[model samples]
Structure formats: structure tokens, C-alpha cells
Target: MTSVAEWYEKNLMLHRFWSVDDSQVHTEYSSLRSIVVSNFEETIKMPINEPAVGKRKSQIQEYVDYYSGAGV
Candidate 1:
């Protein structure tokens, strides 16, 4: 979990745009290197998001922009 968080902190583009303190979010499982934020006991889980960076805007960014904020 620590390693995953570290890698994300070092590589995520969201970090570039916002001061996203994503240390609380860690990957518990990944068949495709996707990001899955969940509780520590594994009782609750959020949707799995595949980090996609391209020349154009990504879906995740659009979602964030639409909502105006993110959630746990």
C-alpha cells in the first residue's frame, strides 16, 4: 500500500494541478494497475479508476471538474 501510494504521488497528474493529498488512498488490488480507493478494513470500496493521461482531457479530470470536488 505504501509503495503504491508513493508511486502515485510521484506520477499522478492530478497532483500537478491540485495539492491532492492522496496518501490516504491506496491500491488494494489491481489487475490492470488501476487505482481503487477503499477503507482500511476493506468494508467499503470506491469505483476503480484507470489513470489515463493523453493529449486531451481525461475522463477522471472531467468528472472532477463536473462535480467541482472529489470524495472518499
Candidate 2:
């Protein structure tokens, strides 16, 4: 494994779970979004899946599996 630090440094970003990809959200409907929409910047929605999730076609998982296979 590359260690969490290496992976983070390469592909780190901040976003909210279940939040839309748009630049901003208007009021009133803002609270409708279940997850928080603050300055969260380390959640990966790419190259993904977690072992815990059983590889259900996730971009995040692919990235992890790829790096794990690469021996880093």
C-alpha cells in the first residue's frame, strides 16, 4: 500500500455526500439535500469502491485496487 498519505496527496478533493455537482445550491431547497454541504474536501467519488462495499462498480474502488496491485 502507498499508505493513506500518498493516495490522499495524489487525488484529494472536498465535497459532500449526496450533494449535487453544481457550483452552488439555492436556499429553501438547500436543506432538502440530506448531507452537509460545507467545506468538506477529502471524499473521493472516483476510481472507486471499498472492500467493505464488495466492489459494486465504484470509481474509488478501482483506484484503490489498481494502486494496491501496483504494490504501493
Candidate 3:
């Protein structure tokens, strides 16, 4: 996620005071390596994910499990 962090840092001005859109953040069934990102204001949405291998689970799988379990 280093690239994401770097991009966020570089574009901090554009995302000023933005908040996560819990309802829209989810994984698509068609592709496990995909993530949907949205803001609380619903002004913007984006998909960010990459193929990665984990010890026992993929990164996207872990994220889906966490958010789903947390009821987000």
C-alpha cells in the first residue's frame, strides 16, 4: 500500500477533510482483487486493488472479511 500512501500524501489537498464511505466500500464478487472506495459526501468513488499473495489469504480477502465482520 505504499503507492496509495504516497498518492494520498501527494494529493492531500484534493482530499481535504474527506471521510470514508463505509456503505460503498466493498469487494466485487467478480474479482476478489478489487476494492471500491467512496467518500462520505458521495462526491467521488474509486476502485483500488492489486493482485497479491498472502500467507494463507489474499489481501483483498482479508479486507473483505474485516469490513464484513465489523458490519461496515
**TM-scores vs. true structure, each candidate:** 0.32, 0.23, 0.29
The sequence of per-residue lDDT tens digits that candidate 1 reaches over residues 9-66 is 4664212111222233333421122354444455554444433344455555566578
Stretches > 4 Å off in candidate 1: 1-33, 37-53
**Compared with the true structure, what per-residue lDDT tens digits does model 3 show for residues 11-66?**
74223233333233334432223344455564765555543443355555667577
RMSD of each: 12.1, 12.2, 11.0
Model 2 per-residue lDDT tens digits across residues 33-70 = 11232235434343211222331533444665777742
Name the candidate, 1 or 2, with the larger TM-score value: 1
With candidate 2 superimposed using the best TM-score fit, by how many Å does residue 31's alpha carbon deviate from the native?
Answer: 21
What TM-score does prediction 3 earn?
A: 0.29
User: What TM-score does prediction 2 earn?
Assistant: 0.23
- Predicted structure with the largest lDDT when compared to the true one: 3
Ten-residue stretch with the least lDDT total in model 3: 13-22
- lDDT score for candidate 1 against the true structure: 0.41
